[model samples]
Each structure stands twice: as C-alpha cells, then as structure tokens.
Target chain A: MLEARVYVIMKPGVLDPQGKAVKSALDSLGFEGLKDVRVGKYFAIKLDDISKEKAMERLKGMCEKLLANPVIEDYKIEILDIKS
Target chain B: MLEARVYVIMKPGVLDPQGKAVKSALDSLGFEGLKDVRVGKYFAIKLDDISKEKAMERLKGMCEKLLANPVIEDYKIEILDIKS
Candidate 1:
C-alpha cells in the first residue's frame, strides 16, 4: 500500500475571502503579530501497492483531473509511506 | 517575519463525505489502484517579527479558537521559516 498527502492552495494573485475572514476574526480575538492568512485544501490518500514513481505520476493525474483547479489553484503531492 | 503552515484533519473515526466523494469520482474517472481518501484543510500564515516559541504559542490559540473544531478535527502546526 502507498500513502500520499496533497496540498492545494490558491495562486499568489488570487483573492481568498475565507482567509481574510480568518485574519479579521483573529484580529478581533486579540491575537497579535498577524500579517496574512491563506486557506487551502489537504488530502490524504491510500492506494494499492505501487512504485514510488508510478504513484507520483498517478497523483499528478488525479490532481489535474479532479483534485485541483489549474486555473487558480496549485497543488503539491508528497508520498508519505509505502507498505507491502 | 514568520511563516507557518497548519494542517487540519478529521479525527480518525469521523466521517469524511468529501473524501468519499473524491474517491468515487476517481473510481469513475478510470483511475486504478485506489484504496481510500480523506480531505482536510490547510492554512498558510504570515506574521510580523516574532520568536519561534511565541509564534507557535499564538498559532495554537488561533487554531483552537478559529482554525479547527476540537470536537471532530485535529490540527498540526509547522513553523516554515522565520526572518528578521
């Protein structure tokens, strides 16, 4: 089995309203030293036994086709562990 | 300045409908070697100059108060970088 983690985040120029809301909430709550906040998505996946190279390739496919929106978001994949 | 990343995930026993939906979507998309999928939230935060220890402490507060729900989710914080 193989396990992988994917992180999906908005591109630098994109506006993130949720993150903005969080920043303001924190500010009201008295938290200091805050400059910016951005929110994204995380996914942990389990897959049948596969080579690391193959897993990476498959993950990329999944990210492009379904997991992330290429227009405004970027995704990164990390293969966490493999077990036979 | 300090940059930190936070990962929020559902507790192991919690239901993740979004992950299930993704898994089914992938299954229908003809991708093979699938087992399971779980989805979560990611946050990237930038802060004004602060010590690593202080940053961590403040981040935990934010997570507890606004970032994550303690009832069903767990959060992990990583101090990505700090620059003066």
Candidate 2:
C-alpha cells in the first residue's frame, strides 16, 4: 500500500479571488495584521502495492491530466508512506 | 512575520464526493489499483509580527469560525516560520 499527498496551488502571479474573499472575511472578523492568504487544494491518496518511484510518476500524471490546471496552477507530490 | 499552514480535512467517516469523483476519473484514465482518495483545503497564511503561540491560537479561532465546518471537518495548523 502507498499513500501520497498532493498540493495544488495557484501560480504566484495568478489572482485568487477565493483567497481574496477569505482575507476580507478574516479582516472583518478582527484577525488583524494579516499579510496574505492563499488557498489551495490538498489530496491524500491510497494506492495498492506500488513502489515509491512508480507511484510518484503516476501521481504526477494524475495531477497533470486531471487534478490541476497547468495554465495557472502548479502541483507538488510527496510519497507519504508505503505499507506492505 | 509569521507564516502558517492549515489543513482542513473531512472527518474520517464523512462522505467526500469530490474525492470519489477524482478516484473515478483516475480509474478511467488508467491509473488503477486505487484504494481511496481524500480531498482537503490547504491554506498558507502570512501575518505580521506575532509569536508562534499567539498565531496558533488565532489560527485555530479562524479555522473554527471560517476555515472549516466544525461539525464535519477537522483542522490542523502548523507554524511554518517566524521572522522578526
């Protein structure tokens, strides 16, 4: 068994409206001195009996094909654990 | 300056339709041997001149109030860095 974690985040130059909204909401709620807030997606996946290198390759494929929008978003993949 | 990361995840028994959809998509795309998938929200926040303990407390309050739905989700906060 293998577990991997993926984080899909917006590129630095991209404008994140959702993140902006959250920042506004936080300001309204009195949590002051907030410099910035960026929101992203995280995924935890479980796969059956795969080697780490193989799983990383597959996970990147998954991200490129479906999980992330390559134009504006970038993703990071980490193999969390492998349990036999 | 303080930087923090928050992961807001669904409770263990909670239904995650988005994750299920992703799993099905991955399967169709030929990434097989999939067991499970879980999707969550990740937040990277920057704040001005706050101690780690105070920031953690405030971050928790933010999670409870806005970042997560307390009934169905749980949140973990990590202070990534503090720069004076």
Candidate 3:
C-alpha cells in the first residue's frame, strides 16, 4: 500500500472568502498578528499494491481530473509511505 | 512570521461520503486498487511575530473552537517555519 497526501489551494490571484472569514473571526477573538489564513483541501489516500511509478502517474491524473480545479487552484502531492 | 499547517480529518468511525465518492469516481475512471481515501481540510496560516509559544497556544485554541469539530474530527499541526 502507498500513502499519499494532496494539498489543494486556491491559486495566488484567487479571492479566498473562507480564509478572510477565518481571519476576521480570529481578529474578533483577539488571536492577533495573523498575516493570512488560506484554507484548502487535504486528501489522504491509500493505494493498494500499485507500483510507485503507476501510483505517481495515477495520483497526478486524479488531481488534474477531479481533486483540483486547474483553472483556479493549485495542488501539491506528497508520497508519505509505501508498505506491503 | 510563522508558517503553519493544520490537517483536519474525520476520526476513524465517522461517515465520510465525500471520501467514498472520490474513491468510486476513481474506480469509474479506471484508477484501480485504491484501498482507502479520506478527505480533509488543510489550512495554511501565516502568523505575524506571535512568539512560537503564544502561537502554539492560540493555534490549539483555533482548532478546538472553529478549525475542527471535536466530536468528529482530529487535527494535526505542523510548524513549517518561523522567519525572522
């Protein structure tokens, strides 16, 4: 099995209202000195007996096709571990 | 400045239809052999000069109060950097 994480976030120029809300909420609560808060989606995936190469290829494909919207979001993938 | 990440995922017993949908989507798309998939929230936070000690304390508060649901989710925090 292979363990992976994918972090999906809005692209640099995108307007992030969810982030802004969190920041403002924090401000009200006096959690001060926060420069920014950008919220994103994290996916933890376990793949069954797939070769690393195939896993890599398939993972990227998943991100591009469904996991992230290429038009406005960016995604980073990390392979955490592979165990049989 | 400090850069941090909070990964929030549902606990083991929570029903995660979002995860199941993604897995089934992968199956339809011919990305076979996925053992399990869990989707979560990833927050990228930037703090302005709050001492790491204070930041740590506030971060935990954020998670408990708004960032995560104590009844269903578990969160992990990582301190990526503290830039001077």
Candidate 4:
C-alpha cells in the first residue's frame, strides 16, 4: 500500500493558542532556545491501487476540499513508501 | 533558526474515529483505492540556539509528557532547516 502524509497548519499570521501554551510549558520546564512553535494536523492516507501521480492529484483534491480549511490553514502532502 | 517537525499518530491497532470519518467521506465523494487512513498531530517547533541533538531530546520529552499519549500514540521527530 502507498501512503500519503498530509500536513495541515494554521496560516502564518493566525493566532495559535495551543502552540503558545506549549511554548509556555517549555519555558516553565526550564528549556531554553525556544523561538516559536506551531501546531497542525497530519494524516497518513493509505491507498491500495493508485499510481503516485494520481495519488498526488487525489490527495491535493482531498486537502482543498475536506482535510484543510483554506481560509485559515495551508496544507502539504508527501508520498511515502508502503513501509512508512 | 532550526526547526523540528514532530508527527504524532495513533499506534497501529488503536481505534481512530477521525480517520474513519475521513475515509467515509472519501468513499462518499467517489474516490477509490483507499485502503486506510490515520490522522495525527504535527508540530513545527522553532529554536534559536539549540543544537539538533538537544532539540531532539527536548522534543521527545515534550512528546512523552504532553504532545502525545504515550500509551496509544507513536511520534516521529525530524530536525529541519530554518527555511522549512
């Protein structure tokens, strides 16, 4: 089976409270050098009989339509081998 | 600035309702060749002066403690260049 790794993140200028909380937690934990952090969603999609080219097309369509909210989030998709 | 990409996914055999919901949506949309789908959380963490080794350690600690549920999810962390 082939796999697609889809990453969906909030737009650069958007506020991310979850990420901010994480950074604050890191600060309280005494970890240093943290500049910023952003949180997002990842989806690993398994396909049985699709070619890589077609899979890419379909995955992009999936993102633009359902997996991501284009008004606030940007998404990326990566094709991966079966073992992943 | 260095960055880290952390991917957190449910372990194999762990029930995933979100993925199932997505798969069903795809099915309804007339897309085929899908075997399975898994959903996860991805974090892009930026650091100013931390080395790759140390960043990894801290990120892993963060994952085990807060970013992920150690009992049900597995996470992978990647060090990234600043531009990423």
DockQ of each: 0.91, 0.91, 0.89, 0.84
lDDT of 3 by residue, B1-84 (tens): 889899999999999999999889988888878888999999999987766788888899999988999899999998877547
lDDT against the true structure, each candidate: 0.94, 0.91, 0.90, 0.89
Candidate 1 TM-score, true structure as reference: 0.96
Quality of candidate 1 docking, DockQ: 0.91
Native contact fraction, candidates in order: 0.92, 0.93, 0.92, 0.92
Q: Give a tens-digit lDDT track for model 1, residues B1-84.
A: 889999999999999999999999999999998999999999999999878899999999999999999899999999976546
Candidate 3 lDDT, A10-81, residue by residue in tens = 999899999999889878887778899999999999987767788888899999999999999999999876
Task: Highest DockQ: give the candidate number.
Answer: 2
Candidate 4, residues B1-84: lDDT per residue as tens digits? 888899999999999999999999988888888899899999999887677888889888988888899999999999986663
* Per-residue lDDT value at A23 in model 4: 86
Clashing pairs in 1: none
Docking quality of model 3: it rates as high
TM-score of chain B alone in model 1: 0.94
Instruction: List A-chain TM-scores for all predictions.
Output: 0.94, 0.94, 0.93, 0.89
Error of 3 at A44 (Å): 0.8
Ranking by TM-score: 1, 2, 3, 4
